[model samples]
Target: MKRSKSKICSNEHAKFIKQYKSKKLTILFCQLGLLILFICLWEILTQTQVLNVLIFSSPSRIVSTISTLYTSGDLFYHIGITLSETLIGFVLGVGLGTIVAILLWWNESLRKILDPYIVVLNSLPKIALGPIIIIWFGAGMQSIIVMCVLITIVITTLSMLNAFQSVSNTKILLLQSLGASKFTILRKLILPSSLPQFVSVLKIAVGMSWVGSIMGEYLISSAGLGYLIVYGSQVFQLDLVMSSTLILCVLASVMYLFVALLEKIVHRRLGL
Candidate 1:
């Protein structure tokens, strides 16, 4: 009787898992179908002259432009430059921001002193500082990276500081009462509790990092997707412009998806 009941329970659990996977697959298919439909409609409209090809630029034209770039051997070169800059900026921004946040969390006096300055910097328009940044870091990749770091760092710091502060006061106090040092409480309790928020910060930082890098490239770059966009516009090659934009969208989506995958892995590891 006991064995029969256990077998029934196991079968039900298996059925539940199968259903869950089927639902996820359906959602994935729907998303891909929607994208395909949009692309087809876009192509159809442009081919029929309903939408001006010069202005809207059909998917086929964009594909042709991409092919030209590929044949010219510039496609991967530009992509590699932009990707490397973005990854570097993303890492530096997130790492430095988190370290600053931890320091702020550790020292209340320092946090108070710097709070207003941090807020002011965050509120100030980062783009307004572009000319100065170029002058300071020159027209190279360094300036572009600095711009990316500037865009993402403040947001990461603020988000992470909030996450650290949001850990339950009661839990913190209990740990203190149990004679745990400040570092122990932070290491064992606060950091673990803030993992979800860190993931959220990563999502936000990904977009910011891309924006910063592209904007920097717009200001001063000889080779990058942003430079291609600028050059295409100058030459009135709308196809090239559209193709670069499409590539940017694809690259950004891939980066975001990577962060999402990391989030899933973290959640699973923590049983969250």
Candidate 2:
């Protein structure tokens, strides 16, 4: 009887696993199908003159522009410059933000004192400060990176500080009752409990970082994808503009996917 029951349970588990895998595969297929359908529709509309080819610039035209860029060896160079600036700024922003969050969490007095200032900074238009930033950092990659960091760091700090403060008061009291030191409580309880929020912050940071880098490029870059868009507009090269925008979309999507993958890994490690 026991052996039969165990065998039945095993079969049910196997069936559940198969269904889950099938569902995932179906979702993936649907996503790809949707993207392909959209592209086909876009191309067809442009070809039929239902959409202006010059303005909408069909996928074929964008592909040709990309090919031209690749042939001229400019494609990878622009991509590399933008990618490196983004990555550097992303790392710095997240790192510095986390440290600031920790400091704020460690000192209630300091947190309160700086709370208003942080809010003011967050509310201020970052772009409005562009001229000042350019003057201070000069018109170069440094300025661009500073812009990216400035955009991302505040949000990261705020998100993380809230996450830290959101820890269960009951759990914290329990730790205190057990005579755990503040640092011990933070290390074991606060950090682990905030892992999900950290992942959420990372996801937000990814998008913000891209926005910052692109905005910075628009301000003063001579190279990079943003530069391509600005130059294309000035030259009235709609195809180039569309192609650069498409590439930016692709790159941002890839970065978001990486953050999603990281979230999965973190969850798996935590047995979530």
Which structure among the candidates has the greatest TM-score?
A: 1
User: Alpha carbon lDDT of residue 208, candidate 2?
Assistant: 91
TM-score on alpha carbons, each prediction = 0.87, 0.87
RMSD after CA superposition, every candidate:
4.3, 4.4
lDDT of 1: 0.94
lDDT for each candidate structure: 0.94, 0.93
Error of 2 at 108 (Å): 0.8
Tens digit of per-residue lDDT, candidate 1, span 1-272: 33323233577887887787799999999999999999999999999999999889889999999999999999999999999989999999999999999999999999999999999999998999999999999999999999999999999999999999999999999999999999999999988899988998999999999999899999999999999999989988899899999999999999999999999998999898
Candidate no. 2 TM-score:
0.87
lDDT of 2 by residue, 1-272 (tens): 33323333577887887787799999999999999999999999999999999878899999999999999999999999889889999999999999999999999999999999999989988888889999999999999999999999999999999999999999999999999999999999998899988998999999999988999999999999989999989988889999999999999999999999999999989888
How many residue pairs clash in each candidate at the backbone level? Answer: 0, 0
Which ranges in model 2 have alpha carbons more than 4 Å from their true place? 1-30, 174-180
Q: Which candidate achieves the best lDDT against the true structure?
A: 1
